[model samples]
Target: MTTISAGATDPISPGVRHVKRPTPLRESVYEALTEMIIDGTLERGRHLVEVELAGMLGVSRQPVREALQRLNNEGWVDLRPGFGAMVHVPAEDEVDQLLAARAALESESARLAARHATKDDVARLKELCKVGTAYHEAGDIDGAVRTNGELHSLITQMSGNRFLVDFAAQVDRRVRWYYTPVAPVRGAASWREHNRLVKAIEVGDEDKAAQTMREHTEHTRKAYHDLQAGSTAEPATDPDPAPRTRRRRTT
Candidate 1:
């Protein structure tokens, strides 16, 4: 027997209707705040006051507080007694490990997609690649990054492996977090690799597809390290400058 409580939803016309499932307000708030943090809208080190977040998200303070506590437990936010909450700046090791996990999962997805991809799947990937390439050329880094995530996610979908899909979903947001720093630096070369990957999947080359995806992910990982290095260390040069050529002619 199906029971609909009067409080379940707003009044509807006196006819049969399907009631959509309602998400818990706290969980919805958590997702919204986490997404803001992952996408850099909240930004690393940005203060998260409960009332401010509540007003911005159009939610009550209690839900926002609960969401912040959840983010804190997940290491996405730091809650302080007096200072409210702040977005946690990811450590180098944290981002590296996240990327490594992403690479492992996505490579499997690529391999499975290679064996399972239909012509339609390949065409969809190509269309997304075109859109991403256009965004990159137009200097819309955010748009390009979003399209890039979509292409990778579509590959996971084509894998037809439910477990892999679930695992990918777990890491998806954190991958975006690490990717944000290197998105502009990666630009066209990244999309070119995606094109190559799609071609491999289209041809049912599992080994090649997996290897390409692995290498493509490694590039992003390296780009992130390079970004960190640039910020913290001086650029390296030849340890020994070539012996100053004796200027015999000048003498």
Candidate 2:
């Protein structure tokens, strides 16, 4: 675990981004915290202290409080009446539901992309694949994850369906949260799969694109489960663990 401290200058971390005061504080706080959660900087099941978060972002506690409430409403935070907020530890069933949803949505997107993609769109995908493969070979996990997201997002955009793009956006972060841990394990093979998907779309082979994407997502799902099986500590469970902190009741 990285030692989180105040007034830190770092490119990437949980709360290293000190919100510039010019922006709307609450919304900025919300976005910052959400990014942290999605990127696994703030791991699931970790307690979130408002003061600490404020110190991290160099903001007042009020904005942090508001952001946590919003996160709770959106299912990213678990806010108990007595307990403070904890990053929501997703249940195994919830992970399955979201991953399954991703597979369905992305497969359809691939099919539609094959039908709608132009030469420029295919060029963009090949570029992403090139950069992504370089990152993977260089052992830059974070770079690989970022490029992987760009590639998938480009495919979704190429689908030419606004609704599909909107739907894919909703699940994108959660999908990244699940995908990050298993990325190294998937390694070069994942890029190979992406190349196959790209080829299918490039050739306007709708069925092949759809099927390739489905298999690619399924491979990620299998990797996640295999990781869980091998690990002694499971991050997710059938039923989520209870919130870890409790506020004291004062008379």
Candidate 3:
């Protein structure tokens, strides 16, 4: 004897589609403000005035206030009792932890992508790589950073693990935030590394893909630290005795 659940195996849905719902004003405002922060439009430690933001975004002050409160809870903004709201400057430990988590997740994504990526997926990655390379070569740091995020996201999608994708999504925006400033420093070399990663996935070499991704992420991490060090270091009046040549990047 066997039991069958109702609607079980209800002929596989005909097409891939998702229902759409209208977003709440507060949520939309939150997302918009978050983007402004992530892309450096808002800048670290920038004061967030409700009325000004509302006017800029063509929204009411209430939603802006709500969004700021939410951002404060999420550590994206600092809301002082009487001083008002300002973007929270990320501490060194915060950036390191987030980037470390990203490295682990993306390295695994590269491994899984090598195992699961279809021919079409590889082709698409190649196309994106070409576009990213063009952006890098043109000295368009914003375009390159945007494409870099896309390429990594595509690799995670190719992993075919929904859980991994969800986890990656959590850190993706912050990663973009940290990456934006270093994009110019990474230059064309970053795209060249991406090409290597794509080739590994295309060949279905899981170990190689994982290793490549790990090294690639490490380079970015190091570059970020280097940039931060340079920013904080006192200006030198004397020429450096050891001026190391920087490796050029593509995207």
- TM per candidate comes to 0.82, 0.81, 0.83
Give the candidate order by descending TM-score. 3, 1, 2
- Residue 49's lDDT in candidate 2: 97
Please report, in order, the local distance difference test score of every candidate based on alpha carbons. 0.84, 0.86, 0.85
Once model 1 is optimally superposed onto the true structure by TM-score, how far is the C-alpha of residue 196 displaced, in angstroms? 0.7
**Model 1: per-residue Cα lDDT at residue 218:** 87
Local accuracy of candidate 3 as per-residue lDDT tens digits, 1-251:
86679877645578867679899999999999999998889999898899999998999999999999999998899999999999999887898899889999999999999999999999999999999888877767678889999999999999999999999999999899988877877666677789989999999999999999998887787777877777422223212222323333323
Clashing pairs in 1: none
Identify the leading candidate in terms of TM-score.
3
Once model 3 is optimally superposed onto the true structure by TM-score, how far is the C-alpha of residue 180 displaced, in angstroms?
A: 0.7
Q: Which stretches of candidate 3 lie over 4 Å from their true place?
A: 1-21, 231-251
